[model samples]
Target chain A: MPPSPVAVSAALNVVEVAAVLAFAISGLLVAADKKLDAVGVCIVAGLTAFGGGTVRDVLLDRRPFFWVERPQWLWGVLLLCVAAMLVLRARHFAVTRKAILWPDALGLGLFTANGTQAAIDLNLPAVVCVLMGVITSVFGGVLRDVVCNDVPEAFSDHRPYAICSFVGAWALIAAEAAGWSLWASLLVATALTASLRLAAVHMNISIPPWDAGGGGK
Target chain B: MPPSPVAVSAALNVVEVAAVLAFAISGLLVAADKKLDAVGVCIVAGLTAFGGGTVRDVLLDRRPFFWVERPQWLWGVLLLCVAAMLVLRARHFAVTRKAILWPDALGLGLFTANGTQAAIDLNLPAVVCVLMGVITSVFGGVLRDVVCNDVPEAFSDHRPYAICSFVGAWALIAAEAAGWSLWASLLVATALTASLRLAAVHMNISIPPWDAGGGGK
Candidate 1:
């Protein structure tokens, strides 16, 4: 039998928390690379961790925001920010270009699945659900890059970021259609998304930049 | 006696539509300045026209979005964008730096008052209501500049943008406290915001940037 709704919700919360941690770490690394102060780091980290889900909730008209409803998640992100900042400072670690990839991949996969699930629960159109999943996975990083005055990697880098989320979201939908259990669907989708992102990064794979002759300018 | 709630709401809608038009124009100018193609222009214009109110609605838990509920607003912005694009193309008009200021100021005033009134109708705390007002006024332009890969003038320029909205929001709140009619409050507040913004621009008034040693890093 499928798991109880309550069981599924609790499991989803755990996954969300992990994703938040991963996103927070990526935010901190980006802030450090930008040479931001402590407050800037905190702001970037908070925005990166909460931005995507906040946007999704707003789009779905969910009241009280996710972090507002569960203050613990906000607190968890704050705690992680402090810990990560301290560790980086103590070790005098220089942030490398690849530093954000692993955690960002984890966050991308988890958030994509969770966002898709929430839209499914709301009975939105399938296309919208998949789009929401991609938005939830990528918008935080987009916001972070924008705030830091860099071109949003999502729009400019020509990377496979949102594409990975898109495919993974469909995978989850397909799994459910194929009569897979909720847990099985979530696990498989998340794994596929993370693996795709990691592979893209490791292999330096990217979509081609829009050509000047393509009417982009 | 104060204006009837229905009368006030109708007036507010008129003001909001005007603001949306102004904001859309500014977005188009910015996108054109950046030499974005037609699709990019449409995206930026739509974002600037809708982004702030959408953010406010999300934060306030208002459903369906303002444009989503009244798709006429969406249509209106699109029409304005197309019209402006054609005019600019036919004339080969260069987008001047000064072109965005007037419409942007008008939008700041109108959106600030409308957002504040919406929060008051919800009976939120006064400070939060004022904050919602400022946010609704400024966030769209911020999003536009960021997407265009410019430093958000709201954060970096210190040219009395958000500060004007802040003061005007409080003016509306204070007028209400003193038993003014809703129309009176909105008019005075909008006038105050627009005048302040215009004066700041004409006078070249700006707050000094934070000192390099102030630790913003």
Candidate 2:
């Protein structure tokens, strides 16, 4: 028998669409923040949505990437960007813009869960699955950062639980393999990432320091 | 057998250094054109130097990248950007400055060589090696464009034989596999890429339009 699809395996096609839209918003927000031109905004938004999946496909040697296989993903990003541009020109968006960080954070959570699940479905080792989750979750942002000319926050000192996404992904996988329901595992994983990130931002919590063997701070 | 030290690959290495420096300069020039700050300049220069290689490694699953493994590469890029800034500020650079286009073309030639050689060393299939070469040559500039709010030249309608790098890399590989010496293969590939690019720039060369099956231009 063929192996199972990842969590919500039967409903994966739906999840994929949602994940794409979420990440597209992540890209769109950055483009808007930069006040990019329409073409520029669309490209960035599309890249943010599909970049991680593309990297995953290349790494896993899966051909005809997600966006390539499903051209609608690209269309969605383009349309979304165009809509965003229209909205921006029509009125100055306030703090409660439709494409806000919270929605993006939800997308990040779903992507982290789905990516981990996909890696697990590939029958890779647990550590690799977790790594895949982190890579997929933060990849869009990393591309965004690189384009914005900043060192990737995921690799830098400031962010908390950017690494925790990897940890949570592994936890989800372990639970699923131990006969937990797919929903239970995904819920746990998503909650872990969202709460950790939210707390980090709001409470200014951080991961404890490693011993650097130096006197600098 | 152990691979030859990069030093034994002296001319190729020199070309690689020149390529990296030229690429870094292009990145810095763009940043300066945008009137960005010092951190932004370093970020752009560093990305231009390392972005292609990093993308290649991630795709190939090669971890602990060259810049990460040899921190000296990062230091070199940082110093180059700093030196450029000092020199630019000390005098009006326009009279003395060679335009970025020539250096960008030169960088493209050398990076194609480096990337082709690396793929060959890895024993990837010939098509894959050629593809890797193109990735190594242009993805940095693509990333730079995306971040700087410009369309990627690679995907734009009007760019020249950026595609030629892939073609030349394959030719070099086939020649080497057919018993050509390393130097001979390198010369042929480099000359083909540079001359073609110059011709394309001067002659307004472009990809020939496919004869649409429906029979329209």
In order, the interface RMSDs are 6.3, 13.9
- Residue B205 error, candidate 1, Å: 7.6
TM-score of each: 0.61, 0.55
Q: For model 2, how does the per-residue alpha-carbon lDDT over A49-155 read when each residue is reduced to its tens digit?
A: 87776766676776545554465666667778766665544234445344355656666677788788778778898888888888778887788766655576667
- The residue-by-residue lDDT of candidate 1 on B68-174, one tens digit each, is 55766666776786666655552333333466688889999999999999899899999999999998999998888878898877988878999999999999999
- How well is each residue in A82-180 modelled by candidate 1, as lDDT tens digits? 887766662455443456678899999999998888787777666667767877888898889888987666654556787789899999999988999
Q: For model 2, report DockQ.
A: 0.05
What RMSD value applies to candidate 1? 6.8
Native contact share for candidate 1: 0.13
Cα-based lDDT for every prediction: 0.82, 0.70
* Residue-level lDDT for B92 in candidate 2: 52
Question: What root-mean-square deviation over C-alphas does model 2 reach?
Answer: 10.6
Q: What is the C-alpha DockQ of each candidate? A: 0.11, 0.05
**Across residues B76-107, which tens digit of lDDT does each residue of candidate 2 receive?**
99999998898776255574345666777777
